[model samples]
Target: MKELMDFNFWEMILRTTLAFAALLILARILGKKQLSQLTFFHYITGITFGSIAAEMAGQTDVPFMDALIALVWWAMLTLMLSYISLKSSKFRVIIDDEPSIVIRNGVILDKSLKKARLHMDDVMMMLREQSIFSIQDVHYAVLETNGELSVMKKAAQQEPTKTDVNAPITEPIYMPSEIISDGKLVVKNMRELKLTEEWVMKKLKKKQINSIDEVFYAQIQTDGSLFVDKKSKE
Candidate 1:
């Protein structure tokens, strides 16, 4: 009980809060790409950041400020590397890695697969996820740097969409706009679409939703229809 009520306990709490806040600010500065599109560098950086933060929070022997400085330095280095990669295509290819053509013109490139450190089973699994069960249907398949497979089916095997079928092209296709996500209003999206909060509220009211908090997600389709998913009571 005495150990729980010590000065070190309170000091640790303060250190943890400071560490977490610092990491959050650094992540925001580093950009959203760290979360959405994590490359090899991003993955390693994330792990390193977490380890450093943990040490800062829990290790009393090591100075908290020193750990924080190290974290900031690492994050800055990552940002610098990202900027350099963006400016130089050669650097980008070397650091981020180039996509490998694992399958070309319906033939599996075994050498490319080996170079990518991927196996036949892995390629087949990735293809199945893309709805291509048979390798014969694949015209081209590239193994992306992020380990995602980009597959193109044979011309004859491709499904015909409305455009391919020569259907009347009505209004220009617009991507759905996310107005609300996880009960939070996407103000940036709203601004981009030139929509007002009152407009979104009116749409919600029409659907018998009293509050924005009741919605889990709300998207406005290209055709001007509001699609809403309410929060489920689990």
Candidate 2:
């Protein structure tokens, strides 16, 4: 009872608060990666990080400065490895496993399943989750690094496209390219879309916008029309 009474509440509060702030800052620096996007290496690293932060926040006996140093060092190492992975494809492959062809030509590859550490049951379950009941229905199934099953159905099992229907071929559709964003002309996008400043201005003028700055957002639509949204009056 005496020892419990002697505990410094303020000090513990301060330590917990510091740990939370550090964790928040580190999370921001690491960038946002969804659960599906996280590879095996990242998942393990995340667990280790959470362990460190939890220890720092809950353990009053641990030195605050030492805990912070350990936390920051771990974050720095993660960042350094991420940089190396970005620069070197080999390093990236080392960190993240290559996608394995678990199923090819409607045949399940036992060797691939073993290498991916997946069982036949697991594969069947995954396939069923994707609405694929039979193994013969899949032409190709890739076990992605994140453990996702990317399936390519056999030609007979796949949906028909416009080309299959013998529909009249029209002009090829393109992605909507933003020529202007937030009242600023995007030169690189303009060049990519092979658009000139004069063309952009003429489109804006059609929308009753006299100047480029008057438009907040402008994009080239798939139909080759200029879509412009005027800036609201301040």
> Where does the lowest 10-residue lDDT sum fall in candidate 2?
166-175
Among these predictions, the greatest lDDT belongs to 1
Q: What tens-digit string does per-residue lDDT give for candidate 2 at 19-52?
A: 9999989878887661224788888888888889
Give lDDT tens digits, candidate 1, residues 19-54.
999989998998998755557877878888889999
| Number of the top-ranking candidate, with TM-score as the measure | 1
Overall lDDT per candidate, in order of appearance:
0.84, 0.80
RMSD of candidates 1 onward, in order: 13.2, 9.9
In Å, residue 89's CA in model 2 sits off its true spot by 1.1
The segments of candidate 1 whose C-alpha lies over 4 angstroms from its true place after superposition are 1-4, 166-234
As for candidate 1, its clashing pairs are none
How many clashing pairs per prediction, in order?
A: 0, 0
Task: Report clash pairs, candidate 2.
Answer: none
Q: Model 2: residues >4 Å from true position, as ranges? A: 1-7, 34-37, 160-234
Candidate 2, TM-score vs. the true structure?
A: 0.65
* Residue 193 lDDT, candidate 1, scale 0-100: 74
